[model samples]
Target chain A: MKSKGALQRAIAENAAGYFFLAPWLLGFLALTLYPMIMSLYYSLTQYDMLTEPVWIGMGNYIKMFTGDATYLKSLQVTFAYVFLAVPLKLGFALVVAGIMNQKLKLIGLYRTVYYIPTLLGGSVAIAMLWKRIFSSDGIVNAILRAVFHVNPPAWIASPKYALYTLVILTVWQFGSSMIIFLAGLKQVPDEYYEAASVDGAGKVRQFFSITVPCLTPVILFNLVMQLISAFQAFTQAFIISGGKGGPLDSTMFYTLYLYTKGFYYFEMGYASAMAWVLLAIIAVFTAVIFKTSDSWVTYGSGD
Target chain B: MSTLAKRRLYAALSHAIIIAFGVVMLYPILWLIISSLKPGTVIFSNPGLIPESVSLEHYVKGWAGVGRIHFSVFFINTFIVCAAVVAANIVSCSMAAYAFARLQFAMKALWFGVMMLSIMLPTHVTTIPRYVMFHSLGWVDSYLPLTIPKLLATDAFFVFLLVQFMRGIPKDLDESATLDGCGRVSIFFRVILPLSGPALVTTALFSFLWTWDDFFNQLLYLNTPAKYTIALGLRMFMDASGNSSWGPMLAMSVLSMTPCFLLFFSLQKYFVQGIATTGLKG
Candidate 1:
C-alpha cells in the first residue's frame, strides 16, 4: 500500500514538473531547437527571404572558403581582435583585481565607479562617443597635442589604428573579469598567506605560490568566457564604422560583415553559412579550453 | 624605515595608482557630461574637463528629437519592453528553475543539458531563422518579437542562474510544506518565490539592462522611428556624414546612461554579489 502511494505521488510530481516546464519546453521546441536546425538547413540553400530557397549543397561553403577575400579579411581582423583584446583585457583585469583584493577605504565606492564603464559600454551612444573622441580634432588628439606636443593621427579614421581603438575600449571595460578575480582572491585563506610569509616568501613569491594556484580556475573561466564574447563582438565595430565596415574595412568585425551580407545585400543563405562556421569554430575552441582546463584549473573541493 | 611607516608609504602609492586609473576610467564620461552642456561648435574646441559657458540647448533640442517622435517616446518604449520582460522572466524563469531544482520529470537530464547548451551557443547563429520565424508570424515591426521570448523563458541564462540559487536553498522547507498537504504550485507561490528575493532582483536587473542595451534586435525589427527604443533612437542621430547634433547627442547619451547608473549605485551590493557569484558558477 505504501509503495503504491509513493508511486502515485511520484507520478503526480512528474505531472507538476511538466506544468512548470511548459513555457521553456515550448520555447526550446519552437524558438531555439527549431531555429537552430533550420539555420543548418538555411546555410545550405540560397534563400533571399523573398524567393523560395534554392537547394545548393555546399556551394555557399565552397564560395566562402575558395574565393571570398572579404571573408578572409574579416577572419584576419577578428583573429587579430580576439588575440589582442582578450589577453590585454584579462591582464588588466587581473592586475586591478590584485589591487582591489587589498582591503582599502571606500573600496565599494571605487568598485561602483570602475564598473560604470562596463555597464554603459555596449550602448550605441557610448560607441558614438568613442567615435567622436577618436575623431581628428576630438578630445583625445586635442589632449595629446596639448600635453605632449604630438599631432596624433585621427585614431578611428586611420586603418592602421581603427581596430586598436576598439581594443582599447574592450580593455577599459575589464570590470566583469576583475570582479570574478576578486571573488576568487577572497576565497584564498589568510592562513596560506601567513604560512608563506613565515617561510620567508616575498609578496611576489606568495602570490605565485598561493594566490595564483588558487585562482587558476577563475583564470580559466575568464579566459573561456571572454574568448567566446570576443569572437562574437559586433556592436562596437558596427556602430564605430557606421554599419558599413568602411574606410577600407579596417573595423569590419566578422559579425558586422555577416550583417551586411544578410541585410544590406540580402544574401541570408550566405550569412547563415558564415554564422554556422563561426558557431563550429567557437564550439571547438570552448571544447579545447574545457579539455585543457583539467591540467591547470584547481578547485577548492578538488572535483 | 619602520614597518608601519613603510606600510603607510605603500598604501599611499596604491591609492595614487588606483586614483589615477579611476580618473582615466571616468574621464570620457566626465567629458561627455561637460560637452553636453557646451555649445556645439565649442565642443571639439573646448577639450577641458569643464564647459566654459554652460547651455541647455542640447538638452532642449535632444528632447525635441528628430522628425515628430520625441525622445521621451523612445524612453517609454524601452521602459515598456524592459518592464514586461522583467516581469515575464521573474515569473517564467522561476517556474522553469523550480521544476529543474525541486521536481523530477521526463527527460529531465536531457532537458537540462539542452538548456546549458543553449546558454553556451552564441546568439548570432540563431538570429536569422528567428527573424524569419517572427516575420512569418507578422511580428516584424512589433514588440511581440522581442518580448515574447522572455515570456517563454528562452533566456536559459536566467533559468540556469535561478536553478543554482534554488538548489542552494535546503529541500527541508519544501518537504514540510508537502507534509502540510501543500501542492507543488502552492510550494512554488507560497514558499519558494518568497525565498528567492535576491536572485529575482538580479534577474530583473539583468533582464532590464540587457533589453535596454540591446541594439541589433531592436534595429532589425523596429524600423519605424516612432517605435524606436533608446538604443535605436540614439543610432538614429548618426546620419551618413558621421556628423549629427553632437551636443544634443552627447546630452542624450548622458541621459541614456542615467537609469543604469542610478540603479547600479542604489543597488551596488546586490549588483556586485550577483555578478561575482554568477561568474563563479559559470
Candidate 2:
C-alpha cells in the first residue's frame, strides 16, 4: 500500500512537471522549432519578402558556391578574424587573469576596472566611441603624431587596417574571458605548485606544466565562444562603415553582408541561404573543436 | 633573497601588469568622457587625457531630442522592456527550474537536451522566420515582439543556471515540506525561491543587461522612431551627412552606460558568485 502511494505521488508530480513546462515547451515549438524549419524551406527559394517563394532547389546554394565572389572573401575575412582575434584575446585574458589572481590590495577595484570594457564592448555606444578613437584626427593618430613624429593612417577608414582596428577592440575587452580564467585558476590545486616549486620549477615552468595544462578546458570554452561571436560580428563593421560595409567592402563581414542583402536589398531567400551556410560553417568548426578536445583537454586528470 | 621576498616580488610584478592593462582597457572610455566635455570642433583638435574646459552644454543638447529622435522616450521603452523581461524570466524560469531540478518526471533528460540544442542555434538563422511570424501575429513594430518570449523559459542559459543552483539546495527540505502536506507550488515559492536568492539576482542582472544592450532585435522589431531603445537612440545620433556631432554623441554614450555600471557594482558580490558557480555545473 505504501509503494502504491509513492507511485501515485510520482505520477502526480510528473503531471505537474508537464504543466509547469507548458509555456516553455509551447515557445520552443512555436518560436524556435517552427522558425527553424521555415528558414530551411526559405533557403531553397527566391523570395523577396513581398513575392511568393519560387522554389529553386539547390540553386541558391549553387550560386553561393560557384558564382559569389563576396562569399569566399567573407569566409577568408572571417577565418582571418577568428584565427587572429581568438588567440590574442585568450592570451591577453590569461596574462591578466594571472596578474589579477595575485594577492594584492584593492584587487576588486582592478577587476572592476578591467571588466568595464567587456560590459561596454558589445553596445552601440562603444562602437560609436571606437569610431571616434580610430577616425583620422582621433586620439590614436594624434598620439602617433606627437610621440612618433609621423601621421598614422586613418585606422577605421583605411581598408588595409580597418579589420585590425576591430581585432584590437575585441582584444581590449578580454575581461570576461579573463574573469573565467581567474575562476578556473583558483580551482587549480596550490599543492601542485608547491610540489613543482620543491622540484626547483620556476614560475615560468610551473605555468606551463601546472597552470596551462589544467586550464585547457576553460581555454577551449572561451575559444569556441569567441570564434562563433567573431564570425557573426555586425555592429562594429556596420557602425564604422557608416552602415555601408564600405571602404570598398573590405570590412564587409559575412553577417553584415547577409544583413545588407536581406534588409537593404530585400533578398530574403538569398539571405536565408547565407544564414544557413554560416550556420553550417560554425557547426563544422565547433564539431572540429569538440572532436579534438579529448586530446588536449584534461578534465580532473592531474599528473 | 628569501622565499617570502621572492613571492612579494612576484606579487608586485603581477599588480603592475594588471594595473597597466586596466588603464589600457579604460583609456577609450575615458577619452569618450573627456571628449563629451569639449566643443564639437575642439574635440578633434585637442584629444587629451583632460578636457580643455568642463561644459554641460553637450549634456543638455543630447538630453534634448536631437532632430526629432527623443532620448527620453528611448530610455522609457528600454526600461519597460527590460523590467518586463526580468519579471517574466524570474517567474517562469524559477517554476520550470524547480520542476526539472526537484520533481520526478519522464522525458526530463530529452527535454533538457532540446533546451541545450536551442542555445547552439545561431539566432540570425531564425530571424527571417521570426519576423514573418511576428508580422502575422501583428506584433511587429510593437514591444510585445521584444518582450513576450521571456514569459516562456526561452532563455535556456538562465534556465540552465537556475537548475544548477536548485540542485545544490538540499532535497531533505522538500521531503519534510511534503510530509507537512504542502503542495509543489507552495514548496517552490516558500522553500525553493527564498533559498535561490543569489541565482535569481544574477539572472535578473543578466536579463537587464542583455535586454538593454540588445540592438539588432530592437532594430528589427521596432520600426517607429518613437519606440526606439536607448541603444537604437544612440545610434540615431550619428548623422549621415558626414558631419557627426561628437560632443552630444559622446555625452549620450556616457549617459547610457551609467545605469548598467551602477547596477553591476551594486550587485557585484552576487554577480561574481553566480558566474563562478554557474560555470561549474552549467
Candidate 3:
C-alpha cells in the first residue's frame, strides 16, 4: 500500500512537469523524431519524390562508395577543410586573444575592428565580396603587384588554391573563437601566474606551463564545435563556386553535394543516404575526440 | 638600457603590432564602402579611399531589385520571420527550461538528454524527411517551414543555455514564493522570469542574428521571387551570368552589412557575455 502511494505521487509530479514541457515534447515527436526515422527508412529505398519508394537496402551506400567519384571527392574536400580550417582558426584566435589580454591602450577599438568579420561573415554580401576580392583582377592581385612586384594566380578560379581561399576566409572570421579564448584566459586564476613568476618563470614560460594547461577544456570545446560546423559549411562554397562546385568541383562541400542530389537532381534516396553517412562520420569523429579528451582536457581535479 | 626602458620598449612594440593588424582587418570593409560610392567605370580601375565622384546610383538600382520585387519587400519578410522566431524561442525555451531546472518528473533525465542530443545532430540528416513532410502538409513555398519549428522549441541550444542560467538562480526565491501560497506557474512568473532577463535578451539577440544570416534552409523553403529574403536577393544580383552587375552588387552587400554592424556596436557587451557564458569553466 505504501509503495502504491509513492507511485501515485511520482505520476502526479511527472504530469505537471510534462505539462510545462508540452511544446518541446510535441515538437520533438513531430519534427525531429519522425523526420529522423523517415530519413533512415528513405536511405534504404529508391525514391525520388515522383514515384513510390521501392525497397533497395544498401544499394545507395554501395553506389556511393564504389561508383560515385564525386562522393569520394566531396569527402576529401570536407576533410581537408576541417583539418586545415580548424587549426588555422583556433591558432589565430588564440594568438589574437593573447595579444588582447595584455594591458594596452585603445584596446576597445582594436577588438571592435578585429571582430567585425565574424559579425557579418555569414551574409550573402560578404560571400559575394569574397568572390570579387579573389577574382583574377581583384584587390589581392593588386596588393601583390604593389607590395612585391610579383604576379599571382587568380585564387577562386584555380582548383589548387580555391580551397585555400575558403580556408583563409574561415580564419578571417576567428572572432568567435577569439572571444571564447579571451574568456578562457580571464578564468585562468591570476594567483597561479603570480606563483609562477615568484618561481622565476618568464612570461612565455608561464603561458606555456600554466595558461595553456588551464585552457585545455576550452580548446577541446572549440575544436569539437568547429569541426562539426566545418563539415556542414555550405554558404561559402555555394556562393564561391556558384552552387555548382565548379572550377573542377574544388569547393564542393558535403552538404552542398547532398543538397544537389536531393533538390536539384531529385535523387532523394541517394541524398538521404549521403546525409546518413555524413552524420555517422561526424559522430565518429566527435566520439573519438570525447574519448581521447580525458588524457588532455584538464577540468580541475576531484570532481 | 635599464629594465624600465626595456619594458617601455616592449609595450610600444606590442601596441604597434596590434594597431597594424587592426588596419589590415578593417581594409576589406573599408574598400567595400568606398567601392559602393564610386562611379562604375573607376570602381575596378581606381582602388582609392576617396572616389572621383560620389553617386548613389548603386543603392538606387539595388533598392529597385530584380523584376517587380523591390528589396523592401524582402526586408519586411525577413523582419517578420525573425520577430516570430525570436518571440517563439524566448517563450518556449524559457518554459521548457523552467520545468527542467525546477520540477521533478518521470523520465525527466531522458527528456533532457534527448533535447541536448538534438543540438549536436546535424540538420542535414533530417532535411529530406522534413522536406517531404512539409511538402505533404502543403506548407512548402512559405514561411511556415522555417518559423514553425522554432515555435515548437526545435532549436535546443537556447533551451540548454536558459536552463543553465535558471540552474544558477538561487532556489530560495522559489521556496519563499511557494511559501507565500504561490502556485508553481506563479513562482515561475513572479520569481524566475524576472531573474532571467539577461539570458532571455541574449537568446533574442542570437535568434535574430542567426535567422538573418541563415541561407540554406531559407533557400530550400521559400521559392518565389516575391518571397526572397536579403540573402536570396543578393544572390539574385549575383546569378553567375556573364553580365553580372558588380557595382550595384557591392553596394547592396555594403548596405546589407549595416544592420549587423549597427547591432553589434550597440549591444556588444551582451554579445560577448553570451559567447563567453557558453563554455565557461566547461
Candidate that scores best on TM-score: 1
Q: List TM-scores of chain B, every candidate.
A: 0.95, 0.94, 0.94
Query: What is the full ranking by lDDT, best candidate first?
Result: 1, 3, 2
- Model 3, B89-149: lDDT tens per residue? 9988998999899889878899999998988898898899999999999998899998989
**Model 1 bad stretches (over 4 Å):** A300-303, B240-244, B280-282
Candidate 2 vs candidate 3: the lDDT winner is 3
Best by DockQ: 1
Ordered list by TM-score, greatest first: 1, 2, 3
Comparing 2 with 3 on DockQ, the higher-scoring candidate is 3
Off by over 4 Å in 3: A1-12, A198-200, A301-303, B1-3, B240-244, B279-282
TM-score of chain A of 1: 0.95
Model 1, global lDDT = 0.87
Q: Please give, for residues B129-240, the per-residue lDDT of candidate 2 as tens digits.
A: 8887888789999999888988887887788889999999999998899899889888988899999998999989888988888877888888788988998888778852
